[model samples]
Target chain A: MDKLTTVEGRAYPFGMKNVDTDIVIPAHWLKTISRSGLGQGAFEVLRKQPGNVFDDPAYAGSPILIAGDNFGCGSSREHAAWALADLGIKVVIAPSFSDIFSGNAFKNGILTVVLPQDAVDRLMEVAKTDPIHVDLEAQSVTTPFQDRFHFEIDPFRKQCLLGGLDEIGLTLGEADVIDSYEARQAQERPWIVPSAAPAVA
Target chain B: MVKPRTLYEKIWDAHVVERRPDGTCLIYIDRHLVHEVTSPQAFEGLRLAGRKVRRPDLTLAVPDHNLPTTPRRDAAGNRIPISDPQSAQQLAALERNAPEFGVRLIGDADPEQGIVHVVGPEQGFTLPGTTLVCGDSHTSSHGALGALAFGIGTSEVEHVLATQTLLLKQSKTMAVVVDGELAPGVTPKDVALAICGAIGTAGGTGHVMEYRGSVFRDMSIEGRLTVANMSIEAGARSGLFAPDDKTLAYLKGRPMAPAGADWDAAVAYWKTLVTDDGATFDKTVVIDAADIVPTVTWGTSPEDVVPITGVVPDPGSFEDASKQDAVRKSLDYMGLTAGQRMQDVAIEHIFIGSCTNSRIEDLRAAAALLKGRHVASGIKHAMVVPGSGLVKAQAEAEGLDRIFLDAGFEWREPGCSACLGMNPDKVPAGERCASTSNRNFMGRQGPGARTHLVSPAMAAAAAITGRLTDVRELMTTQKGMVA
Candidate 1:
């Protein structure tokens, strides 16, 4: 994962509410093991429509997406987040997000900013012709039109994103403490943490 | 005085390995359920990182989502080969990866093969006072047994595989209490749907809901499973009910459950998992079970539901303009008009299986209604898919298969068929289906296929009438005709 500080680019102004994971990447695209090439299948259904914003070259490779409320509203498939990342969407501004989807996005180094619906609407309007900027360090989103909207993020997640620290890395960072805890837990409740015998063949 | 602890807090506290200053914690996972669709990338991630599973014995892999539900035996009762290339590849991937990683893989031909959610509880891997995770959203189904279970993404899946733990943030707790007794003919499915209707799809966002009160206490393990399975549909990652005698009875003698003195100790610990009398919650919702009716979803989202006797809602009824627009889109996509009675709506197909309602109790409920009846002549296709090979065998042993087959419903093998159309069992485009599965999202069953979410009994009734008929009304009408 790459360290994410600021995402500045033209955003796709779809602004569709309750856009579920199914619409993000259909089940058919989930067959592949590789996470690459999902960008081609990202929004395959919506992109097929003539003059759809996803297909318009004007916003191609946009680093941000302006969406409506309840974005990523279905399925726990991480393919939704993979598709968005593959399509170069680094930040998604919506009024709200499904918890599972937000967690998925954060793990993939994508920023999900929850702003008021009015702020989201303004961003959607500005994204039609102008680029928008999101500064994770300052916790604000600003457009060239002098429009600025503040947001909040969990300090832990913000640090992880800025540090490019995945869960494994974070766990390894606390190696000494985890080692001691496991040693104590083994002595306290040996039955709970069973011996790691080889799985049945 | 010390504050009372909710069930969520009790279980969460038990699993926390370390709590950080930023409120994040490292939670130990007791079990990891894996399936074909979601595990491929995760295994690839593990291989790329050159990491081996920290606890291979704690992980179980099964092929369900992409397996063909069609029976794989010939007329001679010999095993036939899988014909679908995509399904074969997904199954082959699991078979190859599981052995190399030292994880147990339940292949398509294995007797234990079933949907991960169904198999977890049935095999006693989903124990009370434990934490479980899977890449599929319906993992909350195991929370019925008092586990802190929820779905995770592939990245988190890989993390669990490598470390046997996850970096988790604590969620707020909400208590949903259903008091009073349920009306006749209304099942837990109705209660779940009604709750979704009461609270919009995003009602429980960022919270874990603890279902309590008399209704939950009296509910059978199967009924509790049905209700907990839909917590994700209401935007909650997980739903839980404290384990009781029913849960203990369900787990006893299972393949993986603790036995003898261990069982006694496990039960004692589970009993202590209840919410304290004076516990407080971030949000509290009370629903009267008597007020709930046989309910079904009328539109795309789970929240777009109505009572069986009610009519489709008009978009104008919504106060929010965005919500109104959503309703319009849903109505247009579902091919329904406002003010139209749901009973008058016709359906072309019926699917009676999913993680939501594919248990022995669900099968028996549907079978009891269809024993002496036949499917309507106007219906195009109807199928009954069991949740697992064990469930299918149990149903056959109980002669429930005969009732379904005798009523002109196809008896299919165990897999997630017709639920999301990942396999060949799909409702054709533009066709309407009365389904017992959870989601009613557009293109969920198949592209452009409309779905009306219902209970098993409601689906059986719809099959008999070729429309959305209330099961209670049909039962009364049949009794009157017989008299």
Candidate 2:
């Protein structure tokens, strides 16, 4: 998959904390190994209610989600990230996100932006009306009315997402460095050779 | 200047290799336990890259999911067919992969087997002052013995398997000290939930907590596990209790445990992992055990809690703008009214099992409550699922299953059932339940199913009342007068 250079879309305001992965994508929907058919199950319980956010036509196909503090609070299930991406949620603006969920979202190319609760409240208000522009390279979210909000991301994760590389890709990118280190370590610590070769098979 | 060092810091520094510029560390994984649900992809990553497990000696795999608890009856004899085909395939994959990579595996039929987290500590694979990683979030359960344990994603799993070290940012440390003794009938589950209530779910953010105090010292190893298991609910990296004589006793002669001189050496080293006198912490929060009442989650989050005798909190009581909105939505979805007495609230079902409280001790407590008693006729489903096969066998041998079955509870096989509806065990949509699981997050039990987190004894009381009633009140009534 190619890296997402820019994320531009409307934001849905879900001002609630502890939005667990189970709620994002229920485990029953995880019967399959494929990534497809996930959007159908994205927030199925939430969508069951009449006039819920996902069901409301006003916020249909919004690519941004403005969430309250402690979003994505439970489970390390990557399916949550997959479901959000499949549903076109490009940026999640929350006061905070669970560490596991944030890591998973980063790996799956979803931008989890941490804003202060006050900033989140403002975005929640603004998302009710206008689209938001998220420029990954610039690391900012801009309102259609021309207000800009800057955020920070781990440079390593930013590089990975921009390059569309996973952990393997990150390691492979430094393959030469790793190989050279290994060659040097072989001379310095020959006892490490037996273990290293055993794992290379 | 005073240098602040908490038990968490003591453990972290003991395990640290070298700090990097970015604040993350290349921490060595002393133990890596994997289960069926989270290992397949990591194995696939390894296959794609042509790499074997970096430190097979430190890695262990176990089969818990899709392994039936019951012995399936065939014409020949009783046989459990790995009853679910997909799980069978995954188990077979592990069987094929583990040996090929020189990793040890505890198969389903192995007598030393149970849930991966359960068996790890039981077999002494997890120890104090070590960093442990698993692909499951509840890996934090191992922290009860003062180990630094956390869950990682599949990619990270692959990273650890390939390198035996993970690049992780160090977390801030906090101390949660509990003074005084727990009242009678209150279990570790109650104490854990009460702490969650006091801390408000996100209180432990960005921190790793070391549980201290006299109360923790008196708690059994099982009780300490219960307390540490739910640290994630409070949003901490993990929770820990310094390994003591109790920990050494539990690990004394278990399979895979260090033997003879090594065992003594390991314990001596573990004793030094404790926080030294005059150590300081980044944050400190103290709780009076006497003030902790049996508590349960009244709303979507673990922090949405109240004492057993308290009423549902009105949204008007919350000052946070977002909390009010959330309480409103949760009340609307739960069909609950503000200021409703928690004791009077009726429930449609009761669930007593999960990694949170599915050990033998929890089962025994629930069975004692239901002895010679029947569940209320209105209570539709009162179910008990064991945490693992070993737990089921232990309970059945003690006739705990009989107590549950006679009380109108459906005793089902274990595999994280009803904990979050991962399998066929689930409450129907819109039904309310008193659950013994750690999480009571929205839709955690099932779609639209309201789950009130309670201790096993309280869940038993709810089973008898068909409503959320205080176990203390039930005991009073059982003494022939309603308190």
Candidate 3:
């Protein structure tokens, strides 16, 4: 994951509400083991249509996306987030997001900014012409026309995104704490682990 | 005085190993169910980073999504190779990674191998008052047993494998209350679809939904599993029904359930897995059970639903233009006309299997409906894949397989067949199917394939009528017979 501070670029002003993960990247594209090269499949269905925002040359490689309510509302496939990042979308501004998709996006180093629908509507307007900017440190999205929208983000996620912290590595640092917890659980709940687990697992 | 906590709060408190000042919690995962499609990248990441699984005993891996539902062996019983090259590569990857990583791999031919969600609880790997996770979205299905289960992305999958814990945040709780009696012809799947429509797609975002009221309390464990399986469709991180006698009875004699003295101790803890009286919830949705009818999704999104007796709604009926436009796009993709009678909508195919409705009870219900009837001539394909090999065996033992097979339905091997486009069992383009699986998302069944989300009985009725017909129309007064 790359350290993300500010994402400033022309955004694909797609304001389609309830745009699910299947619409972001269809199930067929999920057969790959690798995460890269999925940009070709991002919004494959929508991109096939004439004059779709993703296919328009004016917004190619845009680093920000302004979307509508309930974006990324389906499958738990991180491929949806990977495809967005591979397509150069660093920030997605929506009124709300599905809980799992928001988490997946954060893990993939993509910023999901939840703004009021009015603010999102404003960004969608400005994105059609001017570039929009998002700052992690400030927790704000701003347009070139002096329209500034403050956002709320979890402090822990903010730190991870700004520093590109590896979550597993941080948790592994708490090995002692985890071990003691397991030890306590073993005493309290003997059946927690399969007692006769001499098998493969 | 201390504030009373809901079942969700109790589970969260029990699982938190450590809580950070930013409200983040390192919650220990008691169970992890793994499947092929979402885990290959996670395993590859572990290999690249030289990290080993922290507790392989707590993890169970099964090859479900990428493996074909076709026969796995020849007449001589030699294992057959997966025909699709891509799916074969993915299945082969899991086969190698699981044993190499010290995690159990339910082999492709293992009788226990099934949909990860279905196999987890059946094996008693999922328990009450525990935290469970899987890479697939329907992992919440295990919450039917009163666990704090939710789906995760591959990144979180690697996180759990490496640390046995996830960096999680506490979620608000919502209570979906349903009172009164369900109509005779209505089913649990109908109740779930009705809830989706009531809540809209994103209604449960940022919250853990707790199913409450008389309906859920009276539902069978399998019925509760079917309801909780669609929690993701409502945008909830998890949905759960409190563990009761029904949950304990369902787990009592299962292979992985605790034995002897451990059983008493486990049941004691499970009994504590309930909401406190007067416990406060962040949100509440009240659905009268009598209001629920035989329901089916009409458009691409799960929330785009109507009763089986209703007609396809016109996009112009929506007050919001964006929502109207979304409906219009969905109708355009689904190839449905506005105001058309839902029963008049025809289906060329029917699938009665998924984590949502692939248990023995679901199979029996479909078999009961198809006992003497046949698939309509207009239907091109009809298949009933059980949730697990054990379920298949149980069905065959009870002669349900005979009924399904005689009705022109393919009695296939157990796996997530045709529920997704990953495997070879896909509905062809421009065709429509009445599927017992969740998610009517565009192309979820196949490229440009239209799907109507329905119950097993409704799917069987569609198989008989070759269109979306209410099961009530074919159902009779017999206890088990749907006709």
The numbered model that scores best in DockQ is: 3
Interface RMSD of 2: 6.6
Candidate 1 residues A121-182, lDDT tens each? 99989999999999999999999999999999999889889988876866766767666666
The TM-scores that each candidate's chain B achieves against the reference are 0.97, 0.93, 0.98
The candidate that wins on TM-score is: 3
lDDT of 1 at B103: 88
What DockQ do you compute for every candidate structure? Answer: 0.48, 0.27, 0.64
- After superposing candidate 2 on the true structure, give the runs of residues whose Cα lies further than 4 Å from its correct spot: A1-5, A35-37, A55-62, A169-201, B1-4, B65-102, B476-483
In the predicted model 3, the residue pairs found to clash are: none
Poorest stretch of ten by lDDT in candidate 2 chain B: B65-74
Tens-place lDDT digits, model 3, residues A35-132:
89888899988887899999889999999988889999989999999999999889999998888899999999999999999988888889888999
Report residue A161 deviation for candidate 3 (angstroms): 1.0
Model 3 bad stretches (over 4 Å): A196-201, B477-483
* Cα lDDT of model 2 by residue, B1-483, tens digit: 646566677667645444557676656567788876667767877887888786787788886644554443456755556545665666677777788788877765555556777777766777777788887777888889878988777667878788776667778888989989998767788888877877877778778888999999999888888888888888776898898989888877765666665666677777877877888778888999889887877888887888888998899899976678889988887888988999989998999987788888889988877888888877998888787667888999999999999999988766666777655567788899999988887777777788899999999988887888888777766632323
Question: Residue B156, candidate 2: how far off, in angstroms?
Answer: 1.9
Please provide the root mean square deviation of candidate 3 (C-alpha atoms, Å): 1.7
Instruction: For residues B345-405, write the lDDT of model 1, one tens digit per residue.
Output: 9999999999999999999999988887888887899999999989999999999999999
The residue pairs in collision within model 1 are none
Query: CA lDDT of B379 in candidate 1?
Result: 86
True contacts kept of each: 0.39, 0.26, 0.68
Deviation of model 1 at B462, angstroms: 0.2
Estimated TM-score per prediction? 0.96, 0.89, 0.98
